[model samples]
Target: MKQNAIRAALAAVFLTAPVAGMAQETDLAKRVEQLAAELEKVKAELAAQRAQAAAAPRTAAPVPSTAPAQAMTNAPVSTAWATPAAALASDTVFSGYGEVNYNRPVRNASGTQTDVRRAVIGIQHRFDDKTKVVAEFEWEHGVVSASDKGESEVEQLYVEREFNGGLRGKAGLFLMPVGLLNQTHEPTAYYGVERNFVETAIIPTTWREAGLGLSGEFGDGFAWDTGLTTGFDLSKWDPASGEGRESPPGSIHQEGQLAKSRDLSLHGALNWRGYPRLLVGGSVFTGKAGHATPGFAANDARLTLLDLHTRFTPGAWDLSALWAYGRISNTEALNATFVGNPTPVPSSFAGWYLQAAYKLWQSGDYVLSPFARFESFNTARSYAAQPAGLGVPATPYERVATIGANLMVGQGVVLKADYQKFRQDKSLDRINLGLGFAY
Candidate 1:
């Protein structure tokens, strides 16, 4: 009985041990299968991630820190003047230009002088997508005084708007867009240390007035500008004023903001840029200058100006030419009105200039330009033969030649040296040195 019982117990033990061992083995196999499945799923996921990554578009690299800053800066830029207001910068923009000059006359034209020729500060503000305002103030000779050549003036203060179809408009005190230099007279834009004698005497650059104007491009490089402005007052004209006949036409300009508008003037300019490197233009201004002189005839005191200009650039050479003719009717009446004045207004005045420039040398950061200009003008081309031998001085005529060179140290900074020879009543020669910049 003991033996049977022991054997039965041993058998049971053996059976139970084997069953438990099998079950444990099965569990281990299941765990291994599950782990294999999980491993395969992870591998598939990784493959998919890599494929997606490869299919995606790559982004551009950030601006390189080691690249040349000037190369980036040289990129072209569009400003609010051409684009809509919405494209304008949100912050106010400040810009200006300045020039300093040293002049010495060889023939005693004037004593040698060193002075700050011009210092200008401009402020620009964009009010909306289509509206902007600009104002500029200028200081000449670096100071303002009662008994000095220094003075302060407003160059521009105007509001501009952009319309559809390449049309634009501006109002307030602004420059009259007649001549190239009238609108863009920064020193760096031209080669001379001083402005050309023709434009200065005839067109009167730095010419601005309170008026409204329109500018637009029609098509195929055709453009136009027109304006209505306050006319000059003949009452302010004096033969002995040493301005009109004795000096540049600019001297006779009544730039006074509160100027009498008894006579309004109309001016228009047309330009064509049909060729890639050439521009041709013309302008006309007509009005009664004798606003209301006590003795002058009504509208008989008219002033008319006709100007034609052209600029050409071929290779490294630039050439420009301008011819301007001006006429004043009824100068006899003006002479009769002011018989005692020494300086008498001329009935017909004319001027012209031709300029040429060549790039002598240019490097990555430096440029040298050599230029020459020829100008001729007669302020008193024709005046009423003084009534009863009132004795009006001889007409003033100027034939000038300018030779100069400009060294550009940077983008907008220039050093200029020039010599001017004059052929008129006296043969005068002058040497000028100028430093100018814009930013």
Candidate 2:
């Protein structure tokens, strides 16, 4: 956007130079000086803008949207959280995103529902050029109350400080640099109505922890981050419930709510973006989950997860793929304690996916990108060994195929519709429609 402004200003100068020379014959020299001054000012302004643009963290979501990048400028505020990066246009910047969705099962007609999936408000306030504060509040499922099935939570709250040598540090609650979507799941940032099951079920999307961390970049296009943070508390696990079978870490995460600090977790990630329109990165997060809680059967247990992802945007094509795996250590004894439970602790879970999208058409400020994704996920790939004739049945990998299109309206609003087919659970197959915006 700043580039466009620069071009327009230069054009004005060139187009008006001759006119001023002819119209102001007596004060032509003075007029020329005025124009030169204005031109210099415009250039300086654009240069500053370009610097800030360079400082904003780049996302791994598909490119060619052009809309989301401009979403911030279209908003009421001048900036948003620029983490692992530095610079903000205003001292107090408000930026956010929201999405509402409708889903209907293909075969089970009774399972039709519309929902206000999520609404989020993010604020980034710069205390100085080197330091800033970022806080984001989120409302999920529309309403929030004791009786409502909705929730209100703090998605992120942290203070970041820039140090010499290109290093940056942040403290407080922050989102982990995990999977592709975990750091950039702003509705419009991804395709489809619901997030792909592989990410949500295997990696636990929106995962965050309270901790301190450092980030920096070097060597052409390499960036690295390492941090110590709060982790899961296995004592909270419910063997009687199927939560573990859904998302193991998510079911036991602390989310910084009086989080147990007895056993902190460590995480690290490295990314490379030297190639234009291409991004490749991988991350690892591992920690003990017992938190040393007394009488915990899995006191010696640990959790480890890792993933590799890549996104390449060439011309009108947006293509990406990811693979993630997670493990729970020493769950055998833990599962023995829940012998009769319906859902025992799983030994491991993993998933992978490949997705592609094409910019099919464009008109004015509207863009339509049709996409397809195929994924195979297993939340319960294996269980801890149990007594003979008493173990839970073996689980099958669930395969999914999703075909969808996202229509970008102007800068930030997007209309999406998709159909998803499930291989193992036909009842889960559904058609979905959604409207989302980021600004």
Candidate 3:
């Protein structure tokens, strides 16, 4: 009986110990699971915060609106008169240009060593967008001439009106709307220090008359200009010929009924600029020549001209060329007595010239242009000279070759130098240098 009681007590103790240990393990497991759930929640919250921080900068960054960009891209621009509003109110847009020249005769008549060809100042006023006035006063030889002391010659004075649709009108003294160089002859615009002989002697560059004219361009690059001007000789009074006389000794008189000796001219030009980098154009003009004397019947004169001008620029190379020809016609009898009957009555006059230019060293603002020109003309061949008298038959033929370069110093300024070989019946080779600017 005593042995049985001891075994039973031992068994009971062992069973109780196992049950208590199991309860403790169960509570510990529950605590660990709760901790794991808290840890997962914390990790998820941290991940979300990090993602929000990374995305904030992108959402807050600046972005351009559409309307302002469209306005900037569609704005209009112009180079001629600035904005229309500014041009209208401004009393005067101050602008002027000048040239200093040194010329030496290589084979001239007097072998002159020095000549100052030009020094001038110009002023312009804008009355409104459409109308403006311009005047230029010039001094030659750096001093007043003895014959006309205290008198400064007027180079140009004109009023211009611009109309809608590419049309404009001008009156007073302005350059003859004829050749390319004749209209754009700012010294910096050309390579040679001086204009070619063909232009000077035959075309007579810088030729202007008192007149009224109209000019305009069509949509497809067509342009036309015409003017009615005083006869070249009718503008002056000759004491020997009597006031308003149409004929004088050694002068060509006007033909046709007396319309008061006023001359009429018509000119037109066609251009194609479809290629943005290259431009090609041609021009023609017809007009009557001025008479020197009154009462003597003037020989009716007609002139026809043709021109080609082009500019091309690709990479570092820039090239330009110009060519022009002129023809004049008149009746034989009127040509015979004209200008002291210099030739056996020249029936016609004709002349032409070609020029080419290339740019060297075109980087940044620095540029150098080298150029050459060849020209020839016959004055009497196109006109009839009366009574073939004296003075070597007025050969009226001239050939000239010129070579030169232009150095662009800065905005509106340039240095030019050239040497010319003139092979005419009466003139010699000449060398010229000039410095000019405009603003």
Best by TM-score: 2
Q: Which ten residues in a row have the lowest lDDT in candidate 1?
A: 61-70
> In candidate 1, which residue pairs get closer than 3 Å at backbone N, Cα or C atoms, i.e. clash?
85-129, 86-129, 239-343, 240-343
Off by over 4 Å in 1: 1-88, 293-299, 385-388, 391-396, 425-427
How far in Å is the alpha carbon of 305 misplaced in model 3? Answer: 5.3
User: Which lDDT tens digits does candidate 2 get at residues 171-226?
Assistant: 99988887778877877678888898878999888888999988887898788888
Candidate 3 or 2, higher TM-score: 2
- Could you give the candidate ranking by TM-score, starting with the highest? 2, 1, 3
Segments in model 2 whose C-alpha atoms lie over 4 Å from true places:
1-89
lDDT string for model 3 (170-247, tens) is: 888766555555555556555577766555544556555566877766665345666665433322223234221111
Tens digits of per-residue lDDT for model 1, 264-344? 889888887767767788888878876675655434678887788887777777788889888877767567666777677
TM-score of each prediction:
0.77, 0.81, 0.64
- Report the alpha-carbon TM-score of model 2 versus the true structure: 0.81
How many clashes in each candidate?
4, 0, 27
TM-score of model 3 vs. true structure: 0.64
